[model samples]
Target: MVVGATRQSRFLFYVWQILLTAALQGPIKPDPGSQLGGDPWPEWSRSAESLASSEIEQECRQSVDSFLRRAESSLQSPLGSRHPNPRDMLFFLHVPRTAGRTFFACFLKQATPPSKRCAKSYDILRLNVSVEGCGLLSSHDDYSVTAVLPPTATVITQIRDPVDRVLSAYEFAVEVASRHLQVPLGVRTPRPPGKPRVDTRNVWPWSLLVPWMEADMRMRAAKLRSTRDGALKENNTSRREFVRLRGHAGGWAYYHSLASGASKEELSQGDVLLPNLDPYNNPLAMPLREFIEHPIVASTIHNGAALQVLGLTNYSHHRDAAKLRGCVAEVPSVREAMVRVAVQRLQGMYHVGVTDRLQESITSAAGSLGINLTGPAWRGKADAAFEYGDESVAEAEAPTRSDGPYSQLIHLQNQTDAILKELSRKQKELEQLRQSSYNSGSANAVSACFSLRALPASA
Candidate 1:
């Protein structure tokens, strides 16, 4: 069996290589969207040999935000801008599938019987959102909502392994498509006793319904995916570029699943929640490269160096401690600027967590935010494992795996590798920082150490 599997893998790899080569032979088409083009060419590649330190610093600061800083610095200075106000509204920009719904369930204690949480779509709010009341607004957005948040409100979010995030999103797409079409997919485990459950809303996803969607939508989407796939073969793009360009290969599976609704026997054996509605669905929600985009914040600050986009702006790599380090081989400066922005913004956050280290991330963030999140609700059935979409959708999902090779089990290798690599890097960084802080007699040394012993056996 092992030999057979290896042979099959090798065969697939060769077949993919051949397909890619053949696709690359096509003549180039004059496509518009020069700036946002799928081309892998960087803006700086043409003229500059290498960016100077001063130039990089100036450009980084000017382009996005200042350098990264630890959260402890803000905790020490009471007069510093990051101090939390008791009455402050906490704006949780709940990026789908980042263990955000889980965070809301475990840590939050609404002043009222039910939390006065309101969720919104980015399209409705555009780049800015502000409400009169002191409440929580979780939205699918990047760094833009920072402008509208109350000065006292703290921003909190979680990130997943890039590969995991993408894979999970893929599963979620399958789940959602399955649900809409009344197809039985995964199995659902009963919620554990004492777990908190929050209602999640899925706003207008018109494409979910074929009747409402365009008649030729699937055809157009297929052509786009083919064109992009072919283009990718010739372009030799980066992972990020490939993600951006893969315009929805699995969309056809989604439509097939929809067509197969509620009939397991009719279901395509090879479908993977693949959709033919690629161009119509929101790109950000796709398990693609830009899934970690800085929330579209409302703050006047150009760099997004605020508490809202903390995950993006507070880290020198534009990734919070939770974000998986990308293979940023191309356009290093662009990534650097993003990291600066993340770091700068993170300084403003009360808590930031990652899906891989969800237990620690949740606990650590809760401590900073001054929330006590201990109970069966936290350790309960609700925290089954990391997955995506809104809490309600998660609730509705039955956690059964799709049958066969294309199941999530196969995808875990990439996600696991990414997670393991990040965990190792974080461990080294933490150890070094600990030693440096120990010698320097810094208070941050105490706070920086993440306590992982609190996690469950599976975690």
Candidate 2:
């Protein structure tokens, strides 16, 4: 995809060169033998990456803008009598906190037969794109991974309202943490050991995240209940109280309560038992506000939709990668550029769906891909479907207060909200087109090109 070539800014031209020479040619796909588990959490760092020089950053931004424009323009061409083919590939870009799991189970699995669906890549980046005849791949992987796919591959994704997504992510994180931190389901054998060992094998991708959230919530809770003299109130704290806080209160208590009767040696290894604990300060409880403002959480939930689409998110493929709290969107120019590019990509993708419009999206996507849905589609509620170890958590609910503490950070959602509006508009236009075709008794399949007008570069 190439943007206009006439009287282009020097910054835009430099970006175009990079995109044409590198992105267009695509990166070489590595051998499938190097597959490994996906790294959701890297080492934590207090400092963020320093911004590149103004000129350099500007050039990169312009390059992204130019490429997106070209991509949108390329998709504006009319559709043909093409039908679903066995050889065609489908990539479900499963954005987090969206009803992606539900979509996969209800729509994707139903549309693409088992023979053609690839093994789920939600926890691994190494895909067997070479020999596997699978037609579908879904994961929480960022846009950078798309470079591995062939140009003809169909890329589809579902997005949610930014505020709702952030809230859902928090609720899910707390829910997962409570399960992992709670008592083991089966009877436990007494350890014959010098040190208590934590299980680090076959762990979930959210393992690191669980500990981090626990520590943060504990810290927040402690602070809230602290004395005026800056001391935590720990008077007669019993094991039952600890259990209640850890289990029912969503894991918002200190790691080892005095009443639990943990030994000195066991207490010494508390860091191992619960990673990311601040040894200097006792932990506190967290409500939704603190969760939103926590540096790690802020980096993730703040403008996450745009960042994930632009492939600038901190979820690296390598465990050793330097972690960054990506606050680059704080810069006005960068934010605009990112949103513009993301909106363009969303408009141009093989299929774009919104969480609120699940049934309609499924119907539209099924029509575009020339596949029939197995049954009536339905929207999956986050609270109802969120599960732990095959058992449903009994009382999970996302925060509902619109005037909550997270309202202050609502500005961060501006870009994503804009993208949502654009997507809604596209969906509406597509529906109208479909209805007009039906009224005329045309047998043509409504094309996947939802938006014919590309957003201007200046937009």
Candidate 3:
């Protein structure tokens, strides 16, 4: 009996040795290039590129369980029995020029715990972003990004006054253009007695200049559209020529045409900023009056109704909120029902904050979305860190921007005074349109070519 027991023990030992050998030969070593900047205790990677779906789900479960433990621990004080809704995921739709970067920093600080990770990037939406991994995700995108989210995901967004927003966008583009050149054109002002401050850098498109003299721009755009419509579907020499001609509508031409005079071949690399034209100023420049009637102006007024960019003919122009007016009214070619549906979808968003009222907006969002953040920091005034135009030392030093210079010339304060004056006039014009007593019952306001006839109060 003793001999038999010894033989059995020997067999078990042999089996254990084989198992140990196999494990040593092929041990579990983490990928050398693994994205691993999350909770050290948690077995999750930010990218999750090397993990299987099952592994991802496991990691998610672990993370969620840990989250729940932390949440439940907060409630154990015997103060209240009411359970807070621990929302699975939250999304921030980062619109351009909306103080989004400043707000984003606050959001990240408020979101992830001291140890937990927060995943941020436009690319995060490319993956199947789930609530299981982490609670936060943000991007510079529209409603289309919803496809990748789980049902528990809540959306947050901020909207800016379209006129100010556009101006901000334009100036940012100019800065990018200056940076793109070998020797940047931006003027650096001397810092005051205080230490130089660092500011959040934003990702913005460098050369999306909306044309001046709306009439000329529209005429060119229309002519180009007509030519394209009549052309063949296949690529040919005519197509190539047409494409080259289209390049003339880019930023370099816009800047040079206004600055001095640009030729067809004078486009800068990335076609961002062009070489300054000779004479530095032109007598035959297009006036603000001519630009007031541009199609983009009309498109801006009517674009508010579109919830989905796919519905609008020009995705860029139609991004503005037309206060829920229908695109069909402006672009009669589109279907009324479709436009209505788009409007309805936008109206259905969880939260949309006006940029001017950011503090109230975000606080309200936290309550409605069940995020537990509550502090004076989250509820800042207009001059708080969440506000735009407060980050730069130059901006602090520069006096109230007047339409004194055309585009803001950092050097010569009153340089390009012609366009600066035009911009001032344009601001008032856009404001008038924004506050217009237009026909609200009709859905067409989203993208319609609206006239400036002031409707009587009775109407």
Candidate 4:
């Protein structure tokens, strides 16, 4: 019996050693490199690459989450050690073509007093003035030390897909130009003729104008950097130093000259202007091809010059190949590091509590003003069947429907139905939440104001 037991024990020991060896060798073993050159394509390297990407994404998220948590805690504390003055407000650093309009409408309604509700955009720019006693100030101005608010002020901003923003901007510029030429050449109503007024509604072709736009953006960025760095004269009275007045006023001549090195006649009357010239017939204007070719603009518009100028750094543009490639080139080790931190930070800070609180604030304020939070009621039924007759025909033809092929189709359909239902429910819930938030915010603001008024002015 003793001999038999020893033999069994030895067999088990051998099995353990084999497993240990295999475990150690599995990861380090070199299989034939998937690609011809041994450097894996993105897809080929996905297994290993994804692991790295995920790690980086996670680290970046975490870092952002931590930073926001610290900021939120600072805002919420009653001791006021982190945020000394409750009156010190948060500016919604508006990045044009983002969701800034919706946010600003909501924010203004909550912050502004009923008497001063119609305050102009200029009124919002002045730093020292209390915005209807909410103390918040915001503008789409370039970065300047003089423009800086108190450090206690929490500046928040939103970012959008840059390519989309640029496309939208182009469309807007075109619309403005068309509107200016209302009496198109031979129209009966000969309108007062002048340069077209630039507004948010015009359509402009950005692809042909890309080089020009890029030059403008670069100049803006350089100017901003100089001003921020104190290289520009402190007393530089040029409004361009403070705000993007040139672009707003239809001064693309400078950029055009810089980009194409072409005379004004060449720019206005050349083949290059074909895209913008015939706005109605252009197919490129509809789907926006710039996203495919010029992805860097997406990053630049959202987080680069725009954010820096607005003094908001919390939001980030979506990741693109350029960002990934740059990180890979500059600091390969830390390439993944920053992304991971941001992901972690976002998850930690942007929680249910913050969203809930914000919603409550929005609802309460809106309710007091009798503004209906529900804009347009959703008309579709919860269980409306989606028409997929022809679409389903191709899906039904697979032979192995029972397990691998058909099961996937069934699962996908189920998921789609489930997601639609969830989305519908969420939309309804969102409307209610917004109403509640406005109410809560109004009450809080009034309470804060009253409390402040009661205190000794000197104190």
Candidate 5:
């Protein structure tokens, strides 16, 4: 009944009807008592006539409420109390820029035995690897992964503040772009000592986007230097900063000549990707604020967490064109519906973690998977801290004025922040439930459960 109270909720309710119809078409094991024998076509007309719209809505609402209650109870159950199927796999749906690397290294690998871990993959949509006998599968893929996984697979993931995630992703792209350009041209401009370079040219999305990023940075810097004032401004910055920057020195001249003939390379990268329904422009070339507000970037990642959760972020991989908008819907009503759907899906997950609360998140996930979280596995943050030089570019490119671009990004942040809030709430409830079970002497008590404080820093 409550589901039909608002226009947006009503729309969601209607969408559920379509979804239920789609689900019914699938091969579901039928209950012996619920099976209908003869031709049911004639009965359908009578049933539709007899069932009022209000009654249909009420039934739908009851079914949804029942599901929600079941999911909540599952979360509140004592850790390791629920008997999962022997074949039930735990899948980590890794969201980009959510400290997933750290989670995989510090908690996931340490807790689960190597024998049970599935090889990590990003393009799960394209690959057809057998996941049989693997207790854990983690990837940078989205919710569509459930298609290949068993029905009983327990999905787990971490959520982060969208603003931070986007900023981190942008910085990461810049770093990768810098490496790709520098590595091949290392002879012309040697990289600094001890600063490692990775070859991400073979990686997806990055393989597609990083080259464009390099081209964008090169062209922008060349254009800037071409102007008298821009050349004067460039000389004012420190030599070290200028050298380390993406589009300085030989890069400008290189891109300038290439730009005349570089349209082909640029055009290749612009082929319509799911989120970027349109061709990508020189997005990385824009200022930070402009970059955030760019149509391609905003549509793809404005509410990335929810979009990823719904499997709408990678639309090209999936065939459900009607279901996959491939980005955060621009319509306020549709976006609201999307957020609610994402939250509902997240609430039903076996373990939902928050990037901000790393320790508690790890504890809950470890508890759910019945991992002992001790011995050589109990390590403090495996992620490497940023070097001093990495901060140099941040200082130089700091924004002095902001007016409109930030408003849109801030709004986008609010949307993903809602998803983060729901995950945080779930984490708290699980912790409380575990603490209660421990107090009641119903669950086995381990000494200093998940003692992360004592572990030495990763070498």
Candidate 6:
């Protein structure tokens, strides 16, 4: 039987490789069951001993014991001489792209009371991280983290791959901009007359969302014309170019400068201060500029840096920059998926950094505290059902407005709502699977499914 199983495992490996190659190169889609050609990927990839029914419970008990022992040691002798103040325990720093939503869900499970178990309000770790004199903190934007957390508290964070993070950010921006205009998927809409043109480029002038472009322009023109007649007198051609160029650029910057008390000369300099200025028009420089100037789409891009920074004071063992960089470079697909997961889970919400890093840091910290940071021990049961009621209601009540853009906006919202609901369902299923192993005396069931091997001591 052992020999037969080993042969079956080898056969499954070849099948997986073939399917993966097909998926990458062509339109071939592997069904979940046939992906491994009858052999389960999870069981085959795992060590035979790990899945053996005879010693399953024994191994899990031993693993839990080892983890608890490690945790006790960590809690007794936490790294750093200055002990964390118990009063300032819950530190929630919102890191943008790391797997924050999942982590936050874990936190919600830890912090929430059993009686008041609503998924939306259950921040078990968030509250306990503060009230119990234990240092439980997360990196994500929230009034609790921004306003309530003590100033002296330690901040924690996580990061993801840069390219994936940037792409996620772009997708999020496209989603937002699409909602504000008559744009379909894969289509760009024209700017309305007298409205400031939004350049879908690096700098997203957030203030442009305010409907003051025409009024602000008239004010700036009056100021520019007055300046032209006085101390800033120049040739008519130069003056026309300056005004025309400034107007062409958009009024957000000018209005922002004015609001911030910058002088007219300073504002004028800003208008011409092109960060990507290229007098010789070099080809190499153009691509370099495009790369650097690309807007950060997902928050995970800064996870490595944020974790290292936060770890300086929070943890005794800080991950080396080279190691972090290697990790980011190695897991491009996982990073991209994490970004999409986060954005889909928290659409239009203001908790950017909070989602990615905070939960990861806390989980790591929990592991240090001797908690079984994986399996049923760490998983929480979430009851957030994905209801398509909002989408149905919107579809039934088409607005009376004749504006195409307004109708498009409503339609996009419905689509976004559906996507969000589907994502939420997937998330709930994943969570259930994660927690099921713990409840069923099978600690590593979910990890087994992923075929994750324990890193060697050196790693």
Query: Which of candidates 5 and 6 is the stronger one according to TM-score?
Result: 5
Candidate 3 residue 271 Cα shift, in angstroms, is: 37
Please, what are the lDDT tens digits per residue for candidate 1 over residues 143-171? 43342344455676666655554434434
Q: What is the lDDT of candidate 1?
A: 0.37
Q: What stretches of model 4 exceed 4 Å from their correct place?
A: 1-86, 114-126, 129-134, 140-147, 159-287, 291-299, 302-459
Q: Is candidate 2 or 3 superior in lDDT? A: 2
In order of appearance, the predictions have TM-scores of 0.38, 0.51, 0.36, 0.31, 0.49, 0.25
Clashing pairs counted in every model: 45, 10, 16, 59, 0, 31
Give a tens-digit lDDT track for model 6, residues 94-207.
Answer: 343345445544553355333333222111112222123334444323221222233344443344665444434333332233232222212444545543322322111111
Q: For residue 155, give model 1's deviation from the true position in Å.
A: 1.3
TM-score ranking from best candidate downward? 2, 5, 1, 3, 4, 6
**Worst lDDT 10-window in candidate 1:** 204-213
Comparing candidate 2 with candidate 4, which one achieves the higher lDDT?
Answer: 2
For candidate 4, what's the RMSD? 30.0
Candidate 5 clashing pairs? Answer: none
In candidate 4, how many Å is residue 56 off?
Answer: 20
Q: After best superposition, candidate 6 residue 127: deviation in angstroms? A: 11
Candidate 2 lDDT tens digits, 151-197: 45677889999887876676565555443323232223354454323
| TM-score comparison, 2 vs 5, better candidate | 2
Displacement of the residue 204 alpha carbon in candidate 3, Å: 6.3
Q: Write the per-residue lDDT of candidate 4 for residues 150-251, one digit (tens) a residue.
A: 434444444455555554454433332222222222223222344221122111121122323323323333343444336335533221211101232334
Scanning candidate 6 in windows of ten residues, the lowest lDDT window is: 387-396
Candidate of highest lDDT:
2
